[model samples]
Target: MNESSSRRLELVPGGVQLGTGPWQRPTSPSWVLVLPQTVGLCSSDLKEVRRSRDVRSDFGHEMVGLVHSSSMDDFPPGLRVCLDPHVPVTRTTAFSETTLLEGSPDQLRAALPTVLDGTPDDRAAFTEPLACAVNCAGKVLAGSDVAIVGAGTAGVLLAVLLRLKGCQVTLVNRSPERLTALSSTALLREVPKVLISEVGTRTFSTVVVTTASLDDTTFDGAWRLLSRTGGRLVLFGGIRSDWRVPGTHVLLDGIRRGEDVRELELGGRRALVVGTHGATGADFAAAGAVLAAPLPWTAGHIEELIVGRVTLPGLAALLNDAVRTGVDPIGKHMVDIGLNQ
Candidate 1:
């Protein structure tokens, strides 16, 4: 094999830059499997990095790769595994990915079962985002009246998970088209629902915001969606730092500057603001477990969420379209990266 065959997509100060370099096939400890990537891509990978005024950033966190070589006892050559770009490895594990690169080793990693079975191509690539949505669902109390504000990928998945948990879910998004599209899902078809604009006089026990941009309007919308007392607002989206909120409406969590601000009660209703940086390795593993179980929706029904797929060579062009158009890919964008391609 030629040493210069390795190709990687890099973010540069000017824009994205693709570089082909030498990639060493692991030989040490002999058990480490160097699976060639199959497919990988995600919305977060396409987003602009914060404060990277001059530096380029790496993207594409979601990926399914095969075990090409391995010295580990559990992962043998040709075994299929999901590449968890977030967690790093610290110790040897019989059933886990031994060499960690993204997150700490104590973090959890999971194998891709759907891929192993050779079924849904999109499902294999969608594990990361689905796991994230599942993790968000886990954070909320059971059977709570939940309002998912954002009909994009995460919001739709959250609705499905909440329904599985026996919660009454209401999907609220600015776009009526998106809300309508989500309403067609069997997971949400029978649930209580309303567009954010149509939520004239409705409120929920919990409001989860998953939009890309968080502004004052987003806060106001969340406040309107929450019930007066014991209502909680969970921030699951990226927001601008200068976004402001009414102190009395909700308590802010993970806001660095809000430490001194006291919580306030509105109309005898107390609001709690919860902010999570991102999902942990355990969270991703838990998500995989959910995927391994009977899907919350039928395979045919869930397939409606997928927007499209792109080859590894064409990923840059598709991402460029997303950036220039300011549109979120409805379901997921699968990236094919196998050598056969």
Candidate 2:
């Protein structure tokens, strides 16, 4: 087989640059090389523009791929599939020409059914995050008043899940574009920037922070949004530990009276880093179930948020400009790698 050559997204010091590279074939029997069909352009992709190069440079875990080759019989050549990156096996990078989907020996059993949602392959790439969305939604009780901060991938998906699960969800975001896009499905009430500033003033039984950054403004709002007693704060976007905040280890549930995380605790309130409980293979399966099932009238069009499809190189430009200008993309950008079987 010829060596694979493709455009790869590489993280530079302060931005991402498109670089041509060669992907050598995997020699390990445990690795199965795949060609990514579609990659979801996530908010994290914007963060990667400035993220340290040392951090993993892979972009778009939400993807569908065609098996280029495999030593494992289950995933033979030409099979189309999506993967659970959380699973140890098949956690390879998504943007590469020769993508490796690794799995344990036992996992490589007889031919497994290709994961599908009765949608197109590119649309099915959303299953991974939708799965994580399922995991996050399970944390809150149904019909509970929940506020989801951030209208990015995680936030949007969580909003859909909560709306389906009967929670009164309020979707918050700084951008009117995102808010308008989300409100089209009426999956949840959309909070504009003006209203979001006052989100803390209103009380909620649950507050889920999905921005992934706990900057002072966002943190204060989230802390204030939680109910005084028995209120829960679920970190859909995990907290970034700051030395000023105290310990490296964070106590999600219950209060710690120590100097660190003392102020973060509210009166008898509980905290949870959502998805901690159900990030298992079963959770990924649950995500597919949610997608396949007939959803509520307002919550079924999650795929409508997909706005544009660009190539990997074009995505580099879009993300770089987004990071530089501090502007968020209008909607999800699905990168088409032309990796058709």
Candidate 3:
């Protein structure tokens, strides 16, 4: 086999740039070389590009790759794996065609090898985002009544994962097209789907706001869906820094202080608001298991959510378009490296 050159997304002046360079392997004995097969372009990635001014290439984390070579015996070459992006080496550096992962055996243990043997690379790439949903699911009690606002990728995954866990979940979104997309899967077909205008007189034990760009009206709507006595509002999708939510800054401030739960007043009703971001190593492992295991909805779960696929250069084009229009496409867009070669 020949050594591979690396191509990655770089934050440049005016917009994003496709950067090329020689792929370097770590001299350390524990390092592993990975050839990324499929990478998901997360909303967080676009946000990072939109916010930063420096020229940087370390961005793009959701990936499924094959271990091209490994110094450690545990991770043999050719093993399919999903990387944990929280680690320094893999964080925001997954856009490349090749990646060199370096860490202690325990640290590198996050490179979980449980994407089912015959699963398509694209389907397996769902691990990272699913891990995030697993982390959020941990907050709610088992079988709790839940409402998820925003029917985007994260929101839809959250609904499916929570419903499988025995929670009564209602998926609420303003867009019927997105909701219609969910109906294709039999599992999601059972979950109650409601539009924002129709979500009246219904309250949940926990309400999760999964809209990437949250506004005041959505925030208020989420509050209304929460039970007045002890309902919990989860900020799963982040709020724009420039946007303000009335009566919610105090809760946001408390969350920044490391408080897991904060008491707040919404619509004159007292409620608890909690925030969740990213995923843990254990969550990553669990996500891998969920994908690999045989389940009724596993196929649909992995396949239905992907709305579009692009190559590395095509990804740059999408990012450029987002920069120009100030709007991103409504669904998940994957960067398939095979499309490039």
Best by TM-score: 3
Model 1 local distance difference test score: 0.58
lDDT of 1 by residue, 180-254 (tens): 765667656776666677789778888888886677777677778788877877777666554456553333443
User: Could you tell me which 10 consecutive residues in candidate 3 have the lowest summed lDDT?
Assistant: 250-259
Per-residue alpha-carbon lDDT of candidate 2 for residues 227-247, written as tens digits (9 for 90 to 100): 776677676664443313222
Distance from true location, Cα of 295 in model 2, Å: 2.1
Query: How close to the true structure is residue 101 of candidate 2, measured as C-alpha lDDT?
Result: 52
TM-score of each: 0.78, 0.81, 0.87
lDDT of each: 0.58, 0.64, 0.75
Cα displacement (angstroms), candidate 2, residue 265, comes to 3.9
Report the C-alpha displacement of residue 6, candidate 1, in angstroms.
3.1
**Model 1 alpha-carbon drift over 4 Å, by segment:** 1-4, 24-40, 49-58, 89-121, 246-269, 296-303, 325-330
All candidates: CA RMSD (Å): 5.4, 4.8, 3.1
lDDT of 3 by residue, 254-312 (tens): 35224277778767678778878778888877776777655565445565677898888
Position 51, candidate 3: lDDT: 76
TM-score of model number 2:
0.81
